[model samples]
Target chain A: MTNSQNNSSVVDPRGPKPRKIMSRRNIILYGTLLVVAIYYLIPLYVMIVTSLKGMPEIRLGNIFSPPVEVTFEPWIKAWAQACTGLNCDGLSRGFWNSVKITIPSVFVSIAIASINGYALANWRFKGANLFFTILIFGAFIPYQIMIYPLVILLRDLGIYTKLPGLILIHSIFGMPILTLLFRNYFTTIPEELFKAARVDGAKFWGIYFRVMMPMSLPIFVVAIIMQVTGIWNDFLFGVIYTKPDTYPMTVQLNNIVNSVQGVKEYNVNMAATLLTGLVPLTVYFVSGKLFVKGITAGAVKG
Target chain B: MNSIEINNLSLNFGDVKVLKDLNLSVNKGEFLVLLGASGCGKSTLLNCIAGLLEINDGQIYINNQNVTWFEPSERGIGMVFQSYALYPQMSVKGNLSFSLKNAKLSKDEIEKRVKHASEILQIESLLDRKPAALSGGQRQRVAIGRALVRDVEVFLFDEPLSNLDAKLRTELRVEIKRLHQKLDNTMIYVTHDQIEAMTLADRIAIMRDGLIQQLDTPKIIYSNPVNKYVAGFIGSPGMNFLKGKILQDGKPIFKLEGGWCESPDLSNYKFQETIKVEKEVWLGIRPESVVVGGEAENMPVNFNLEIEVFEPMGADTLVWSQIGGQEFRFMVDVNTSINVGGTLTVGFDPAHASIFDLESEERL
Candidate 1:
């Protein structure tokens, strides 16, 4: 607590002395935060560095050290030709598979969840709350517990161990939270708005498409972020549902990096890991602005 | 045919009966204001008329059509909500024209209606701005404009100006009244504010406990409330009541505090035909009706009382004093110089007073 007289810093005209950026308190505060940030970022740094380095340089130097020789060979191999058991093609197969799975899964799950949320918020029928309670409670249970039952059900439908089966699994697992997210967000909307819309001649689907959906873009973006990241990085359901050919990117990435028959090309594995994470990472960065704030700020009179 | 009609309307929220056997009718182009305290079912009744709430037992007819089972839109009505439910993502013009657009109206027709509404509301400049960009009063104007574009037979409002500040509320209140005058549609407005009710309504329905306690013109409801509750509720600084007994004699005098005040001429008063002597009653008088100082000399009943407290309001002053061992409030002109401890003669004429029965509370 340096007094204004003791330091060569500008004193605030409002009387209280403001902390200077170079003050001891700010130094320690920002210094500690920077340390924590770097601590979290160290692994990402290592991944990037490892992905760029040739194997010879990686072996010659420490993992944290700058590479003597950099190469895109590992990235090329990871993207096109890394082997996974009988397959020579690499993470690209799983990449495309994930795109196919994640796109439909995100769209279908959000579409159903937003509509479900709107209905639960505005329209009530017998047993709606009962089923909603069950759905929310279902979110808390471990996904592993339902895997076997889901497998049998998918099998009965003759879609087990297929891409559609994986898509169905993602939607089912994502429902509880997504529905709850949408329902709670939709509830905050003034009930009068719904009434006004109805009096303005909006029907159920009409209100949903015209009123609720446009008004809920922020929540939709949040839901998409959750579903994209959740389904993209999903390893458990992918392994459980789809075979190797149709396996999602995470499953194929895991198989490629952990394959036991060859030498552990560490650089290639890092490259493949970063490649697999690229989709969700891109989504997060692109929507990162709307993700934090201002989506629903002026939507209602505060 | 009446513009809107309700037959045997009853609504229940589970076991709680919110509205009971309510029946009402409105003439075309009449502005009806339902005035009540919170949870008095005034808003519920408006919702029922708007087809927003399902009545457990009732038939609602609009324009001679039994629209009880029809969807709200099909009933040819538009409703404005308390929250000013403008579609946030839409501009003022968009919010006004959304339903028209949804109805697949032609582009020129939709644009024409929107322009007309904007011009009517004096919001022509705010057309391109979103609701979030407009001030609260402007947003409400757009909300009204939304309903105005529909050209419906009936317009329902549920405390549309409650969210604004007091100054803005008064401004919007006058604007809404003007809207009603210009549109000449059957408007059913619900509000807890007596000023809004009194100023805008052609007929005000005062409700309590899910029933319309009194329905009449504002002047009548003010001058002659139907019951003790109606008298107590309709005014600010509400009506003061003094408990006394009416002694039926040669001239029929109201006996209180060993003094006999002349009974009001009741020939025009509507009540039970039977008159009883030694019957207990309560005399109600509005704050403004209680004459003070030199004014009391002209009234039928006059008394000298000490002012307990003097509150100087800007335009007028409210003086509180005790009369017959009961606290009474009376209004005086701001220019009337008065102190808390000063004595002033106060009086009220019986014709301007309401007398209610002690047992039934019905006016006599």
Candidate 2:
């Protein structure tokens, strides 16, 4: 009993040893991470501080400093009174326009792309490989090259410079990458599951809605985050595709900042930029965990 | 009456033929097992019958109706898969009812069928549990219940118990057998495990290289396999084969190639055709058929050979030895005193052995 007690009392040396709190490796790793984080965070800090300050205070020009007298005037003006073109109304209209474009575009693109992905992954119709190859190839082409042709096509169709036209463009442009993502994700699901669904009397739409759709919530969240951010922050497409009245938030913000006629109120510009960025930020934070889960879901076997 | 029939079925994947000219007829209320190694097209054949694959050429008839062009849902058959393909997002009840709801069955009918299936599968308490929450065996039971709720006339199982542990596999095997006896539906099961095939099947169709080698009752397949491949495949620890030649003396006798012991008599062995003198042949003897100790004294073919290895497997022990310079194995009771390097007398009745032609490998 004494020998057993002595043996039990002795510390085992087989496991990991205790190390200093500030080891060199940890210091290097954490210090590098902290530095990189601050590098990305400092611009966001400046934008927040600048957006809260008045024009005179911003003119003093210490962007790194916190606001001495925090005010909501610039935000209110940015939301209701900033002039983009002839309209003196603010980013609120642009925000609504962005919302309209994003909601429909995200839904429409996801709907079409998910079906296309399901067909490509599960169904073996003729020429499917060719169709998938063409779709994936479209993802690699620069958007700038397609813009002129699309403009001409939309003009001929008589929907040019309209929200519907812009919505159509965003939906079409989002398809190739979104379809590829969904296809790869669907492929990760067991083929037996698809076969079982088929045997269970679920046809194409039935399986898609009931079985595939329910199991694909993570991918849907990922797709929503992707499309919302892409369409909301789009400046080139929004400017070229729609009139100033229907301009998305990104285009309206550009017009407010670089009007080339009035004294550029930097605070109002910063406030408009912050306001324009808020939608995508809110979406990311709301579904951030799901987005990560979606990305890594296909990496491991279920 | 035939419940499922395949006429000249053929499937190709690009340039490679996966299944070639396959024809099968499953009887009503019969349990037929498609047994083969991986890539032998057993699961592929099951898939074809289920209408899950578009066959390159075939006519599949179910319940006297041609279902070659019909959708899987229209074929009146339900299938279970190796992965227990229950909808991971839904509860067991939802999984069982999803297809019924699609079929537009009345709410009361759907509930009644779901209750009946869950009761039969003993998963009534797991109705609200998702597949992810259940253990593997429970999930598989739910999968079977999903198929059962459809009230299909035929059930196809594709290695359904493969994903479970050995103990669970045995338990579920009995459950599946019990389910079949209760349902009395035409069932086509695909498995690589011979023990499962033997125990559960009314008839076993052993396949190799996209062709059916033999389709017979398990006893016939075990005792008189049609080919060398069937003989080699059906038994655990496998049948022992000795390369020899059949010499026609006053009576038929098998001469071992290495001539290590006295030749065994083949007078009592049944031949499929007239035997040729001095023809190359393979003599196959099942390990358990070879008797040891005092039991060997009464046998026609008896020999004493030194044991090289012994594996004690509870009730029986498998002893490996060399006869005629070729490895020979036999099973003895575990209580028997057998050790490596000990000489032991072992013998088998020639009637129980199989003789195969050397070049054709066909039973002779």
Candidate 3:
């Protein structure tokens, strides 16, 4: 009995002599993660150092150099006004436009995606598999292929080159990926929960609106990051579909940096680039918490 | 008070039929377990009851209200998923209150219910933390809390305890049992693990190849299994089978290949009336029923054997040896001083053994 008790104590978590040892593989795993961390930090280091330098200082171009003149002017110039066109309004105008596009696009597209993904994953119907087939197939099609048709369609609506138009375009193009991400996420969720909801008198829309949508916030963040990045940095559709007045930050940034006559504004360009990346970057950072939470909560139980 | 009833239910995924005319009724407030091996359509059957999967042809009624065409949420059930499926963005309180929020209940009422649920699940301290902050068992409790907060009549658990470690599984199993006892709600649980079914369900339904092979109380499943499949599936180490023959003298005798004699009483059975045995039979014996080494003449059904292999478990030691033309295993006292190739008389108890028609594989 004493031996049994000793064995139980050793096997049990609270007692001494933890049986689980970090294997040799774990050391290699940590070493690999450390290497990856160094790789990921390299570009950010360059960006920060580059952002600190003036045009003349930038020309010297030692990637590791600490700027002799640590000035915030580039960041400021990118924010307030750098000449995108004759209208000296800087990256901020496009930044606001990106916000306008990303907000509606992310929410609308993600909402639709979660609903569609849930249906495809959990619900059954005759054409459901076909719908999934079409959607997955739609995801592989190049983004450029749909541009002409989409631009024409928006132009016919007369809301073309407007904020809503850009938002709509972003949503339409983003549907496949957003739906796909949510679908894969929801697939890992056991079917019993849906059935329990069904037996609880949860209708299709009821479960989707209440249980599934609420349970899908991680995929939502993932969708936000994807859509924000894709739509925020978009130039082709933004240029063709929107007027000069409504151009997003990417288009404006391009016009400023790409133009030969416009005096090259390196500091402003870098600042604008950082600003353009900021919303999606911020979204990724903020939503990353939820993403981590979702896996623990919704995907893995043990 | 919701009782789910399925009639003539069959579901096919593409060309493969996963469920075939499954007919079963789970009474109100009863805990029903669908136990089977993986790919046996137990989960599929549970989904059909939950109204998550559409039956190819059948009717599903919840509390006598036909809900074959109803949506999942409208089916009046609360389910716990194996993955937990807790809303990550929501706090434990938020996750618990979400369904109530969707039900458009007043905020105060939602809070009251969420509070009660958290208390019931013993997760009140972790209500404010996101799922990321909680341990696996805690997350599982929150999942149960989420299900409990929604006042559904039928509870569905799709292998909810599968993700838990063995110790945590035992802990949560007791908690689930307590919850069931308190709520007295109809619950349909699906698991590939028979032990879970045996410990939890009021009645365990065994499924094989999309059909329910046997449905009975745990005791009956353990002792009075209808076929070899049920007999093998329900018990740890399972029941053993040996080739035997029914004699003309109304005696069922098990023939041994390596010079062994075993017998189990078949005088009360009607196997001969159903199918002619023609001297071919299968004798089934559970390990615990058989004893090892004693006076050979005193034993009713005794066989001489050489212990070929032995496995020691603290309480009991398993003695495995070749008997008849097949391998046979028997459990004995752990202190049994037996070694490989040692000669000893193995005793078989006649009363606890079962006889089956060899060709049909059906218990007689």
Candidate 4:
């Protein structure tokens, strides 16, 4: 190389140097993170291995060992033939039930809360603050306190022990936080945009549909992630509101895993447990980036 | 006929009166700029005209129709905001055609309007790009196009250039001025920048404390300011004032701390009331009008002052000095060889200087 090129290749004393991969700091940092990863993965490891083992091997008693004799019998049993009370049909019934509850509940809750949030953020009615304050505080109240009252109300509406009753219950409980998430997100939008929409000849519903709804995709994804996980995992409302035949996955999982039957099928229980958690896990993994971004942007601003 | 007229408009937020009994009128195809500092209600007034604000008491007429109680869209006006406010999820073409689609315009009409606007703005290549992919200037052009497609009789701008950098602000400012000329639509613009107001306005309304202080053509407002506030606000390196008193002896002389000079002949000078001796006044003169060096030697009115500093500004030099113990600065041609602490004689026309009553701050 020429003299100038040689000089350029030489390291400058003031500039940062590249770090070695095996540096003491990197070892300590990544070592601590690796330990954490193993700690979290252990239970998942046990679940998969246990579910693959037959009952006789499960009784041989090393829960974390890879199954010596692997079989798909437990998975098939979890899907079709395990008993959850008198109905011998397995989690498929409850899986489909959870699907029915989750879809409408997610859509209905997000639709109502987003519009409610838009109104609260932009349109100021008299005593709106009073009602909003109550709603926000209501989010902290224990669901148990309102359960009995909701049961009476649903009975009056003739949706008691019905899927719609549980859907309504999930939407009602989801309102406060979903509204807060959406309201905070919508307020971050410039006030001038709302005014511009109005000036463009949009009224209340027109602005919501044309302007606010389209710009709010990230927050909607965040809302969907929240509602899906929440409603899918909900056992209290499902147990209280639905008949045994209409039980959601969580309630059915409980009956299948813990019921005092002829014999406790541990492998089938582990497989069923893993199956029930799969929907939320899939949603979380798929929406991981947007979920983080949405929360960061939707964080409350003054 | 007037394109817009507001009479006796007032607005209040609780105890604070943001605008009070304000009245204004815009001739058809007129470009009126509302100029003020922050919180002077310039934007508020524009909002009222656009029907974005509900007035406490007033009548607003647009194109000879009373639109005081009408919705903003029904009032037949379009607006551009400082933030640009393009719908983020939409592409440039979608943003431009969104409102038209809402108004139930036919697809061909929407396409034609969008095409014409993009062509006029030279933003044809940007139609498919999302706002996130566009630069600030491109997003602003799409915003302006959004209003353009509305085809309204009046266009309102609320400090639309404030969010841009200086270079882009100037570029978009010229583009807006060109748009106004080509469309021949009445436009009302709001800005705190005096240069933007002075360059773009056909008639400028200078406001303070929620009131229109003075409304006139840029030349009239600049050359003949009505009061001390107007004189100080219109010019860059704002008008310099030497506190003094009017000496009505012999020939109406103005006496300052260091010395005195002949006051402009006030025989025909319009005064709200008759002038008297010992009346405290502020004598105001713009920096560019202050003559320096050889030009000062033959003046009928002059001051011999010591230069505290001289700034060489390429095109012209700004010389800072003190007169009567108060700081004063004046501009001179760049060729002048002046140094710090040097003495220079400066002159100005008494006719061009303004004398305001110190107590009321109004012109005498």
Query: Retained native contacts per candidate, as fractions?
Result: 0.80, 0.90, 0.55, 0.93
**Per-residue error (Å), model 1, residue B110:** 2.4
User: Which lDDT tens digits does candidate 1 get at residues B1-364?
Assistant: 5999999999999999999999999999999999999999999998888888888998999999999998888888988888899988888888898889768899999999998888898999999998889998888888899999998999999999899999999988988888888888999999999999999999999999999999999999998888999999898889988777776566556665434333544333344446688788887889988888888998777878898998888898999987667778999999988987999888777766888988888988
TM-score per model (chain B): 0.95, 0.99, 0.93, 0.96
Q: i-RMS, every candidate?
A: 1.0, 0.8, 3.8, 1.0
- If scored against the real structure, what TM-score would every candidate get? 0.92, 0.96, 0.74, 0.94
TM-score of chain A of each: 0.91, 0.93, 0.81, 0.93
Q: State the fraction of real interface contacts model 3 keeps.
A: 0.55
lDDT of 1 by residue, A215-281 (tens): 8778888889989999999999989898988988898888888888868899999999999999999
| CAPRI-style grade of the A/B interface in model 1 | medium
lDDT of model 2, residue A207:
85
Cα miss at B288, model 1 (Å)?
Answer: 0.6
Rank candidates by DockQ, best first. 2, 4, 1, 3
Higher-scoring candidate on DockQ, 2 or 4: 2
Candidate 4 global lDDT:
0.90
Q: Which candidate number maximizes lDDT? A: 2
B49 in model 3: Cα distance from truth in Å?
1.8
* Residue A6 error, candidate 3, Å: 37
- TM-score winner: 2
Q: Give the alpha carbon lDDT tens digit for every residue of B1-364 in model 3.
A: 4498889999999899999998999889999999999999988887787666768999999888998998766767777888887766668787777677667889889888988888888888998999889888998888788778888788888899899899999989888999999999999999988778999989999999999999999999898788888888888777888776666446644454344544445555445355453567677778777776764346567768878999998899888887755787888787778888996677765556766667877777
Candidate 4 wrong stretches, greater than 4 Å? A1-16, A300-302, B257-272
Best by DockQ: 2
